[model samples]
Target chain A: MAKRPLILVTNDDGITAPGIRTLISIMNTIGDVVVVAPDSPQSAMGHAITINAILHVEKVTIDDGPQTEYSCSGTPADCVKLGVREILDRKPDLCVSGINHGSNSSVNVIYSGTMSAALEAGIESIPAIGFSLLDYNWNANFEHCKSFVKTIAENVIKNGLPKDVVLNVNIPNITKNEIKGIKVCRQARANWEEKFDKRTNPMGRDYFWLTGEFVNMDKGEDTDEYALANHYISVVPVQFDLTAHHAIQQLNTWEFNS
Target chain B: MAKRPLILVTNDDGITAPGIRTLISIMNTIGDVVVVAPDSPQSAMGHAITINAILHVEKVTIDDGPQTEYSCSGTPADCVKLGVREILDRKPDLCVSGINHGSNSSVNVIYSGTMSAALEAGIESIPAIGFSLLDYNWNANFEHCKSFVKTIAENVIKNGLPKDVVLNVNIPNITKNEIKGIKVCRQARANWEEKFDKRTNPMGRDYFWLTGEFVNMDKGEDTDEYALANHYISVVPVQFDLTAHHAIQQLNTWEFNS
Candidate 1:
């Protein structure tokens, strides 16, 4: 018999979140599974690592499953690092993050701890994917996403991703039958127009809650936003090489004499 | 005389760091300055926002200067959002983050609080730059960086960056006369080889410190790592559009039938 592929599973919604529980089950069917994820919710953490403090990890059995799980006191990115470096004796064949409780589409990718975990794995030269649903509810229907997730993950392991590339997969909050097939897309041009909710504490100290309106400025139909709106799962191949190579020549034209 | 441009200065090293103070001094010479940075050090914060908790901003004077300063209880990205939406009456002519205590070159750009601020500004369509010195000391000499910082800021104000692009500038720790000129470069292919220092706490629980060896895998002469090592200030224009456009066609061949 062929050796079972080793799979590392993680999410930003914490180790016990239903989203990851579903992901763990899906991975167990495909390969040997090991989960290393944050002990508490770490949404919107981006690519942060725990440098200022020590991180604690506890091995636990959350459910009756073939997969072994470890809860971590660190950001999503840190979980991937610890899993790859400390927990596993060898590099996992693949790393999958999320079934995130909400969308990591468009500019949201910049604020996504879910995607950050996958990006961290990608930086370590592992084929990785971050899966998210358009729904924000914890009990949102991840059952509908099971087959699609498995197929994508299986394909990634078989064909392999481009070097330094990871997948940002966002499924629309729709039933499996209602969903159209997956579409390869680009990230949409979008931003948050911040609206601070200012208030004074009883002790008279002023504070503000960070809230914002997401404004999508792109009209391109090939974007992740467009795919999601059309009820198709969007798979944007994401890269960590942030260099805007096209802009270099123009920047070079500018005078920088000191 | 025409109105002097409004310049927003910030950093991950906190409001009292010598790095931002030097940045503020340089911006003061070029335009009207406003410093809105984190109240405490927030290095490696990435693109995190304070959505889970309240944020506080206090207007104050750290030193005798014409520039207005505000200390913010948030990440470097939060400082930029608050500065643009609540503090500044108008969009800043240019937003500059850091003269960071350490390098944000190569793959460090993904985990940099300094670059996150600059990227936040870029998302808002504000021309932005994040500056860093290679030294990691709190008292790293920044005098040698003044002229280069000023030159870059002036050029950015004159030649607006491409849409969705921000500058990641990393300066080598050398005297002005010893330094070579600036180089427009690409982000080097590199990553941390994590060495988790596992230990037992006083309470007898195992914890780990996230430490690493930075290994540069790219041999490209045009990379930021190459430029920095050669005593040149490295300026890599970075984009928040994480889409690996080149790989989109390849991903389209994936089987993701619903």
Candidate 2:
């Protein structure tokens, strides 16, 4: 019999969130699951690590399950670091972050705590994936995506991910019957048009709320945006190497004095 | 005469940090400068944006300088967003973040608040650069790298950056005379081998301080790590698109049931 993969589970949503709770249950059926997640919510914390502060991690049982769980006071990336370095006795076969309550598609991946966790694991050479649903509600229905999630995880365990690569899987906010199928795609070229809502405090101090409209500028039909809009689960292979390799030759032509 | 460029200056370090203050003074020499930076240090903050909290921004006079400055209670990325959407009357000719207190070379870029600000600007189609010194001290010497900083910023302003690209510049901690020239390079494959310093609190609670030894895995002479080690200022063209386009074909072969 093949050994069950050692699966490390985590999420940007706090350890108690329904999104992670559903992820935990789904992961347990496939592997020797171990969860090391943030004690509180840490959305939009892209690739952040706890460098200036101390981290506190404690074992906690959220529900009846065979999986071992520990809650940590840190960002999602910090959780993965702690999970790999401090908690896990051995390197896991895979790391899966989030059944994120919101989409981490396109430019959102730059600001996503969920995807950052997966990227962090990828840096450590762990086959990893960050799963998100298009729904952003706290009580988002995750039942419809359970089988899909299980199947994806099984496939990743069966076939390891490429070097320096991790998966960003975003499911549409639709029922299982309505979901067309999974599609591998590139991230769309998109950005948030920020609108800061300004208000004056009781003390006559002014503050602003950060709000934005997501604008997809890419006309490519092969993008994650196109896949999700067509009711398909979009899986973008994400890499952490930020280098614009194609521009290197052009940059080298520039003259710089010593 | 060519119109003076409008340069937006920011950093992961607080408004009062020596690094940013140095950056502001340098940008003043090339253009009409406006400083919008975090109120407190936000190192390793990545691309975090304030969505759950209201942001407070106030105009302030940090030092005797020609540049106008504003301090915000947010991450470096937020400063760039606010500088673009609300503060600047016109899109700046360029955005320069940092003269950061430490190196943002190799995998450090993944966790860099300094680089994230530059990336945020790049996303808005603004030419941006993030500069860092090899020294991590708050009071690190900046005089040695001033010419290199000025040259790079001038070059970026003169030759606009490529589409969807920014620059990650790291200077060696050497004297001006000892410095080699600047080198356009790729980000080195490196990672921090985290060593969490576990300690017990007075209340009998356990905690950890995150620390690490940087391990450079890539031996490429054309990498940012090699340039910095050779006392050359390293400039790696960076991008915000996280897609691993090379891996898409392989991922497409995976089986996922609808």
Candidate 3:
């Protein structure tokens, strides 16, 4: 028998999110799937790895599927660590994270629990990808994402992802038919124009809730933001290293003592 | 009166740690310092922020210094968010994070709370930096870091950090005199080989404590890893965008069928 591709599956929206279920269904069609993910929501956790506490992962049967699954008591990155280092008998052929319920484009990638899981796998030298939809709603339509997800996954399985690089795929929230072709792009020059909602607590103490308006500063039509707006599925290959190579030379020109 | 440079101070080791205390002491000499830091340790948190929970900022007196310090219940990113959004009366002239108890060079930058705080500030278009020492011990030597820290801070103040970039400065564990000059470098291509120590609880439940070995894959001497190894302070300018621009063109070559 031909060896089936062993695909490791995980997400930030927890084990029960429809997004992962959609991701799982796609993986099953392509490979022998093993799923490990957070049992509860871990959105916006970025790259948090559980170090201050102990992590517990218990096998759970969520759907009637051929895939073996485990639910973890940690962040999304924690699930990737548990999946590769403990759960899987050997390194999987590929690791795919998130048909995430929200966008991981532009600066959102830094705060994405979805991409963090994928970056964790990339750090472990595994080919990895993170998939997200521009929609943030839990009930956002994911059926349209199936083909793109499969196509991307198959491509990764066929042509290995670059070392230390992971894919950040953000699908436009429109219907599958309305979606244009996929566009490989760069992250947008964007940021949240944060407006803190200050309120008084029950104890009459001031507190704040993080709220913001999405501000796209880049007018370039080449970025992920532009691609998504043009209705294309934006695929940005992201690496874990946060270094700004250009600025290093600028720092070098400065005399530290002067 | 000459305007005092507005220095925003933060750290991943929490506002109370000696590392930040030492940093605060030094910043008092150069500028008007205002600290917005986490009340508890946020080590290894990466770029995580408080989204689901309400954020509370409580002003506290750590020690008598020129800086006014406030402790907040959030991750390192949140500290920067609060610092820029609410704490500071105006945009900071420069933002500085850490003097963290350990290294945040190479692959650690991706998983570092200290560096993430700096990156957060950079994202907000603020001149920013993150500093750390080679020692992970709580009582790690800070005396040696003085000259390097002062120099880097002064350089940033004088020349202003470039757009969309922050600096990750790693000092050797040796005394300030034994420390060689600073080197502007790239993040070493490296990662932690995760070794989870799985154990059974008293209830016979399985739990894992994340552990790892720092593995360097990049052989280039132009990296933070190599510079730190050679007893020089490594300054790796960092940014939030993780997009691999070189790989974008490569992934575009992949045939994706609808």
How large is the C-alpha RMSD of every model relative to the true structure? 1.1, 1.0, 1.4
Q: Write the per-residue lDDT of candidate 1 for residues A1-258, one digit (tens) a residue.
A: 188999999999999999999999999999999999999999988888889999999999999999999999999999999999999988999999999999999999999999999999999999999999988998888989999999999999999999889999999998899988889999999988899999999999999999988899899999999999999999999999999999999988878754
Predicted candidate 2 versus true structure: per-residue lDDT over B1-258, tens digit per residue? 288999999999889999888888888999999999999999999999999999999999978889999999999999999999999999999999998999999999999999999999999999999999989998999998788899999888888889999999999999999887999999999998999999999999999999999999999999999999998899999998889999988887877753
Model 1: runs farther than 4 Å from truth? none
lDDT of 3 at B200: 100
**TM-score of only chain B in every candidate structure:** 0.98, 0.98, 0.97
Chain A of candidate 3 compared with the true chain A, TM-score: 0.97
Better of 1 and 3 by TM-score: 1
Give the clashing pairs for model 2. Answer: none
Q: TM-score for the first chain of model 2?
A: 0.98
What's the CA error at residue B139 for candidate 3, in Å?
1.9
Q: Write the per-residue lDDT of candidate 2 for residues A1-258, one digit (tens) a residue.
A: 188889999999999999999999999999899999999999999889998899999999999999999999999999999999999999999999999999999999999999999999999999999999999999999999899898888888888888999999999999999999889999999999999999999999999999999999998999999999999999999999989999999988887773
Worst 10 residues of 1 chain B by lDDT: B249-258
Q: Which stretches of candidate 2 lie over 4 Å from their true place?
A: none
Scored against the true structure, residue B69 in model 3 reaches a CA lDDT of 90
